[model samples]
Target: MDQITNDLKKSLESNDAYCLSELSTLFSDRALTDGPHINEDLNTCYGGVLNELHNVACLNGNEVWTSGDKDNIYLYNLKGDILKDFQTSSTSCIQDIAVTQSGQLLYTDDNNRSVNIVSNTQIDTLIKLNEWIPHGVCIASSGDFLVAMTSVDWDHTNVVRYSGSTEKYSIQWDDQGQPLFPAGYTTKYLKENKNLDICLADPDARAVMVVSAARKLRFKYTGSSSSITLKEPFYPSGITTDNYSKILIADMCNQIIHIVDKNSHFLRYIKNYNLRSPRGLRVDSKDNLFVAECYTGRIKKIQFYR
Candidate 1:
């Protein structure tokens, strides 16, 4: 761990973007060389109901949040123990969950077609669109909220930006005036890269769409056919970006997590880690990865950064 910290410090001192990018690959190689092994008994969190787990997010250093198919969202310790659970007052499945800049919890209320925010002991409606249904909710690095929304027919999908309840921006079309994303109800999970680019996982499209901070089309990453780590017909689900701009995508069909750089270049596959249907992913502040498995209802904590 000390070595990894020192390497990152040195890379930051150089102030070179290329050096930083190279460090991400170095981290991946080190983990692979050391034979990434899951400390099964030590890192697994297993208090969720069987086959009920849906999504997960890192709330803080000590707390990880998970939502199930029911109306409950649970907070658990790093070890396998339930700390607490909250009922959203609606029985519909919570599509996604995220933590706000002020330490508030945010989630998609699919039952009401709105984005809900939990602050202090009160859950309030943060953004409620009239005709649009919210799927994924994320707090941008700039402290604003980014939500993936779609129409009822799922024929149109786009991301909406909101500063509290007021609309700020909308990202829909590409640079050439084409639809930026394929119409689907599932292309929602999104995160802001270290460079402020928007990265989203589209399960229906089997691709990850990356857009510039200015809402311009940057690149689209389909799975690499030549790579042995990643399989074809990529069905990406939950997506996240670490502090180093490395994107972690959950491939549900392949049952593996693909790590990529800021440019959407393939870095490595986090395979052979005993993962089954990894649906939700979150990298904590200490670079510890928390993965939620849909089938087993377990959250696995891994030390990939070291």
Candidate 2:
């Protein structure tokens, strides 16, 4: 394992993509939990009324909102009490959900390719696309909606910004006019880092793609290489950013979360505590990490900071 780690480090330093790919393929079958795990323990695990939770959003660091395919969106308090249950517009499935700075509930309807907001009076469509499907939704620091959308064939993907139903900016093709992200149906979860850069997790590409505040490509971080051979592919699902600008991403297949610094340096893996297919991830203002375990229908609130 030590030798393999050393080799991976050398390969990374040399920018050897072929060597890294071969290493990943060779180790992609060991039990995902076999490697070194973090020592942090989950503060609480809440179950009941949650099934196939696809995403989570935190409001004021106390209230939590969970979305699923059950035709309902759930809101819960820190004590695990269900505060509200709001019905969705369709039964197909809610692709993603987010909480705006003003406390409004915003979500993407996958079946309708629409973005809606739950206001004090009613649910209304903020925007609807005819050629693309919305996969993930988040509120930027500037109070605009950052939505991840892809074409029907999954041949093209883009991050669009909407300011109250009007298009503001877009991030798709790079400066070279080439596609910036791989095409796929996988949901591309995204969030704004503390420094205002957009951090995106692309499961199809098995990598995290970062874009600068000015909408330029910053960097792309693939799964970090390790001495301990891995048994499965690096499938990043849910993604969020902490106050420190650390990017935390859920590795669904690997059953772990990868933590990366602001500059996109691989820091460490948060494992242990028997995380099972962890998905929807959010870091509260207090730095508490909330993880949604998909298959188990449970939410694990963990304290990653001392």
RMSD in order of candidates: 5.6, 10.6
Q: What is the lDDT of every predicted structure here?
A: 0.76, 0.77
Q: Write the per-residue lDDT of candidate 2 for residues 1-306, one digit (tens) a residue.
A: 537645554565432232221233333322223444332322223333454767778876677888765768888876777888778777677888899988999989878889999986389999989999998888875588899999977899989989999998788987889988788988888997755678888999999998876666778988776634446988899899876667899998889888877677777788767898889998776677888877766677777665
Candidate 2, residue 57: how far the Cα is off, in Å: 0.7
Residues 1-306 of candidate 1 have per-residue lDDT tens digits of 437646555565322232222444444333322444554222333334553566788878778888867787778876757787778976678889999877889999766888888876588987777778788778876588899888887898888888989998889987688889788876378988766688888888888998876677678888774567445578887888887778899887898888887887787788767888888888888667778887677777766755
Pairs clashing within candidate 2: 28-231, 29-231, 30-231
Which 10-residue window in model 2 sums to the lowest lDDT? 15-24
Q: TM-score for model 1? A: 0.85
**lDDT, residue 208, candidate 1:** 91
After superposition, candidate 1 runs with Cα above 4 Å error: 1-34, 39-50, 229-232
Clashes of each: 0, 3
The segments of candidate 2 whose C-alpha lies over 4 angstroms from its true place after superposition are 1-51
Query: Candidate 2: what lDDT?
Result: 0.77
